[model samples]
Target chain A: MVKQKGILYDSTMCVGCGECYSACKKQNKLPETNSDFLKDHLSANTYTVVEQHGDLYARKMCMHCAEPTCASVCPVKAFEKTKEGAVIYDAEKCIGCRYCMQACPHQIPRYEWSQVSPRVRKCVLCQNRISKGLPTACSEACPTGATICGDLDDLKIEAKKRLSEGSDKYYQHIYGLDEAGGGSVLILASVPFEKLGYTPNLPKQPMPQLTNRVMEKIPTVATVGGLFLGSMYWLTKRKNEIAREEKEAKFKRNEVK
Target chain B: MKNSNASKLSFWKIVAAVIMICGLYSSYIRFTKGLGASTHLSDSIPWGLWIGFDFLGVGLAAAGFTIAVMVHVFNIHKFEPIVRPAILTAYIGYTLVVLLLIIDLGRPQNFWHPLVMWNLHSVMFEITWCVICYSAILTLEFAPVVLEKYNLTAPIKILRKISIPVVILGVIFSTLHQSSFGSLYLIVPGRLYPLWYSTLLPVNFYISCIAAGLSMIIFESYLNARAFNLGLRLDILSGLAKIVLYVLIIGFLVRITDMIITGKTPFLFLPRTETYMFYAEVIVGTFIPVYLLSQAKYRKSRMWLYVISIFTLSGFVLNRINVAVTGLVASSKTSYFPSFDEISITMMLVVLGMWAFKLVSTKFPVFVELENLKEEKLPEDSREMILSE
Candidate 1:
């Protein structure tokens, strides 16, 4: 069986070396923008960034949720959660609605807005490398094991171990373990995840589930509601026809009398 | 008098021509230069004025089904006169919405992808289908008017036979999609502010749209009366206002009750921009119109009715804009303001719709009284007949 792969990011260990940033650009073959790389957030050209929160450094990218809202919300299924545990995108199928960007709980998806033929851009967990039995470039380039790539189950165990063993250094919580409903990526930080600019108030339940609850009712509503409306037309038409007949009959009886 | 009317028409024609020219140029820039260069949209705020206007268009177009239900299903013959124009307005409104969607989409050529691609979980997918199906339904419902103009008696007879079922389907489609538009926001509870977000968002949207739709019918009637020299049907206008009043009451109660039940009422008192906008939307859009229309004197008066309808329509516009734009403001890092080109294109669509409506009204029997319609046998070549006149 193909194991679901994921990344464990240890913010406490990251040295803010900018190695992962350079490695990611090289791996993705994206042109380096002239803008200050340290100051940049995720964009069409940049998928991952190492954010500095005071003294500590954190890596920010797609959370790649177990039940990704972007995949669920895409009308064309352009985004798919692969068995390899990466949420990959097919630009060919994309109609460029950019709804994926809107529906993402983490707001990680970026768009090539300036291009005449734009594509929704974001981290795919380096699916191509993972499929080829290789770790992501950022993970392989990290000197201090700050970013580790492995099976998601193993990463969860490792994340918990670090949190419990180094309680003095690491924050008690694993950031992505249950955020927006159990993302594939896990983060162990010394400071609160919110201090690292993480969205603080995500529900434990998956965002897609919120939409699905309402969307699942559509078929039932269409069927039952269609029947009700159809019957209403019949009933109202019948009532009007009977009323017309009765009026004519009464007029005929009066004429005969 | 004839020359004055002709001058007035020419003036409008010139204005529409200028707007359309500007719109075409903006659209050219939009298509060639791409979304980044043309509009003020960014990754954080992906949807902007175009989407907001799309919401407004759909909300205002709610009249198509509301009037259809009243006249055809409930057998409210008094509203029968306004039904054609209501359907026409809906058709024009929906056409503009589809046009805007195409313009907003990054891959406008791939607009047809939704037909074969099935993502039933997405509200947007559902909405796309509903709009398509509803537009076809609107076309069928409005076909009789076109048929009547062309003096196609046989098809008219057939259409009349199927009209009831057609109307029922129209209402069903409108209901599903109108509420589904609200459902579009339900996924964004994390992003949309608490003041505007609710699981009951769909229900609120459905109800408010009914009130707004009814008001639109009244507003259009007033416009039709002024533009076409048709006498104001005071009785019909007053009756519609009564229905709008009832809908407004129900909508207000539902919204307030939902807020209380969900324990989100405290958010209403928050000293936030969204909170103030929310108050303005509810008070000016809903409460004031309800109060004015509730009075018999205001309902009977032409000026009061016109002014109240405008207020109601503005309130509805504000509500939609709040949901689509304002509510999402605090969450995004980048603030969005629509560029000049964006506003121009929106204005162009409005002018285009108005021009088409005027043209059709003149060429067709859209404003004819239902009672008088039976007495007139129009020529087969009505276009030529009108031109000759």
Candidate 2:
């Protein structure tokens, strides 16, 4: 029903300023994490973070994958990639299996570890902000326009343009372009993505694609297999039992004689 | 029925109730205190002793399906005496698995949600349904024993008439879910180490279950001999071991083929802890037992047969843990290790399951034939009388 696309972030243009992190926290109403070493709330409550790597700073959040592992494995249908390309979570439907936590390749989803009934917390791409014709909290807060939000095709064009002209600075690869089946959130980084904490070895094909193929066999295996096996067991046992009965009857007749 | 002392049952029942109460308390803590506080599970290692023991309980309990297949399907008259007791063991073991699952679920209350709102795509969802249906099938298949114990001959006859269909269905369901348990991890291909990953995981699981199930029956028969003071039935044990050895040979060969086809042969040759463990399972669990059982002299030796049973069980446990936990070594966020509380809770469930089994066997006609007991006892008594003269 609703069409979906997302932002492509060029990490090379990003300044190490905490503007996006603060804006996201403010927008989401997340509490500030008071870790002694790390003052950023993005580790827990803030949905996205800006990590400082040497002279460059990378913007990190949910990749909004086309075939999300979280959505596939969530025993309860909690984590959903909405038609509009936002990977959203509903706390009400959450079973707290943390299967989403286990399934996620990027490890983007965070849980309230201390709570008895914890919910998975992650980015929804500031859907409320975008509905009001404004960019995401981090995108609006950015001074250099490093974080660009738009349609998928538009972002791809932008990414390719930057890759071709800015070869001296760019890594030639467009991270998340084909990774995990073309996620809504794309990243164009100057350095190797491994340094920025991206899963470099992840298969380009979506995680869900692999499992969906495997799961398609469940109906046949569970129902049809059950029936066939059950029937064979029935016939064999009945045949033997009847033979045993006949033998016993003959033994009784002989004894009577 | 021979041990129909009400006082004895009541005494044991009280002990059982106390143990169950403690397990319930641990379970309550598991739910209320969060997994971090209740068990040794961590983000890196979400599964622990409960999963391992679940595999152990299921593998050991394979006796039920194997014995059922032998007595009913294959019409193996020699193993008929073992069929009822084997079914009872299976019933007990499955009940334990259900209990362990509850303990492991982060939200146990939401467990029924899968049934209420089905997830047809989820292998775990399918397994949940299969186990439930199969357990019911087993109950129906085993009902004649309970009816006969109560002297309900008419109902027992009716049950016997329909038992063929029920048992066939149960076997099929058992096979499906047994393999589906392995397919459950197919979702984590990227996370699961290549050493253990195989598109043929479901097939591998089913084969191992068959081998484990047969060996378990052999092991249980030995336990019965010791417990009941019935001298070991070397003939039956050896016969059963021969079957286990056959199944293991097929299963091992399949595994080797799978590894080779998947190009994971390099992993087996390469030095790694998981690879080494895999080798140990293949060698000690399947190969050694196969070789020993192949020899007429070794198969006849009671001590050697017992040793093979232990090896088979260890191998079974290792294979299951590899599928459930060890396979996910690459994706593990932290070092996965079982915690102390997890071990205790796991032990608590096992002890309870065993105690329940003991109570049922003593009170019910689980071991239906006392002819073997009588036949053996008469010889010793007569020999003593002649010696005194």
Candidate that scores best on lDDT: 1
Which portions of model 2 miss their true places by more than 4 Å?
A34-46, A127-134, A222-257, B1-25, B231-233, B370-389
Each model's lDDT: 0.87, 0.74
Q: Candidate 2 lDDT, tens digit per residue, A176-242? A: 8787776888899888998987777788888776667767776676587566555655676577667
- Highest DockQ: which candidate? 1
Measured as a fraction from 0 to 1, the native contacts recovered by model 1 come to 0.70
Model 2 whole-model lDDT (C-alpha atoms):
0.74
Worst 10 residues of 1 chain B by lDDT: B380-389
**Candidate 1 deviant stretches above 4 angstroms:** A238-257, B1-10, B370-389
